[model samples]
Target: MAAGLLLLVCAGAVLYSAQAQDPYDGLPDDYKKGVDLAMEKLTLDPGVRHHFRFLKTLDKSDIESGFGVKYIYHHFYLKPTRCAKGSTVSNAQTCPFRNDRPLIDCAVCYKTAADQIESFPKPYVHCIQKPRLTEDTRTTRTEHCKKMNYNSGAPTLLAVSMPKN
Candidate 1:
């Protein structure tokens, strides 16, 4: 019975790890509201009324707290559309809207010390109309939000890309 108890104790202690955590676990309610705002108004074109399809918010393990503010990254995928008139396309293939799928990221910085949570004015995360080359250099839109620096401690999202077709 003593040996069984010792084994059980060791097993219990080994299984009692508590580091498990969700990146968005302690996120402020306003963050969701901000995402909603982005969803409602985020568009591919200001003049064309082309709205973006909200994919997901970029996740980070370092999002628990900050002194003054927290930046919430909201990512949305925008399909390629015709380039607006007067825009210079040096290679024609490099025409931003013609070949590459634009991944627009809205990074909203929320004031953490605010007295009013919901009433706080929405963050002005500008639309990223530019696209970068994909990591694999492939044209398919496989660039969903994921953590970087796998072995290293600091995880980050690589910039959205415009890979070669």
Candidate 2:
């Protein structure tokens, strides 16, 4: 009877361990390390702390055969540390929309698994707007923000791309 109970306990433990495994465990070691470093920066920034929301995945291995390149892009939004006087915003942890700000795009990329070098390339992060808006720009932004759990008000600001001389 005791042996049966022990077997049951062990089974339960095994199941729990399987469920607790990280979903990204299959990712390359460098990619995982880079993501950790990026997250650390977001949490450690002194002014205007930012948070990332995963946007989409880009698998380029089919096109770029040798390097086994893949990318996951995340966009950063300002974390609300302060509120306007008499503002309805109540959550300090949640980011509120401010018209003056622009969302920053950050790309985490992974190259061939064989490469073991640390800091071969850092995650590419930028606040610069795309040179121009295409027909699909609005649709894409809306979808991305929706995934990020922001309200409808957050993704509506259409950026007007200025012409280069």
Candidate 3:
């Protein structure tokens, strides 16, 4: 009986440590700040609660990564309908060809297209806006930013979210 109790205690300790070591555990200070900022901003939008359940799923790293911010914007702007079961694709932007097709009914085509895009070089791109500075007679002038491109294959905006630290 004592041996069994000892084994149980040991198993519990191992499980506790495993949970503690999860990748998302102990997020950085910067990440927490980002998340707080995002949450504050999101709270002001009336529709945020309805549309963004995954906001809770996010950790501080997600906000810090900028993916969380983009995700909120993407869903707010695009509002892609969720795919049904057995669907090969999740995002409508990724599968423009089959806009009307039900993903569950046409799994093979969806899968093939999704796979192709996945393998396609630079499938996803992000343009970061940069301010342009110009010299004027009186003072320096700053113009509205231009988009700088970032390449990635993930279809969803979440793909680019904060990397695990």
TM-score of each: 0.32, 0.35, 0.27
For residues 1-165, what per-residue lDDT tens digits would candidate 1 score against the true structure?
A: 999999999887767643223223344565555554554455434553433433345632223233333333343333334544333324322333444455655544333334222223334443444454343422122222122111222222222343546
Model 1 pairs whose backbones collide: 132-161, 132-162, 133-162
Q: Superposing all C-alpha atoms, what RMSD in Å does each candidate have to the true structure?
A: 19.8, 16.4, 21.1
Q: Which lDDT tens digits does candidate 3 get at residues 1-165?
A: 999999999999999988545231243433333333333344454543321111122211111123221211111011113432222323322322223322110000001121121222212111111122124411211111011112223545565675866
lDDT score of residue 101 within candidate 3: 21
Number of the top lDDT candidate: 1
Segments in model 2 whose C-alpha atoms lie over 4 Å from true places: 22-26, 47-107, 110-123, 126-165
Candidate 3 ranges beyond 4 A from true positions: 13-25, 50-165
TM-score ranking from best candidate downward: 2, 1, 3
- Clash pairs detected, candidate 3: 65-162
The candidate, 1 or 3, that scores higher on lDDT is 1
**Alpha carbon deviation, residue 35, candidate 1 (Å):** 1.4
Please report how far candidate 3 places residue 144 from its true position, in Å.
Answer: 12
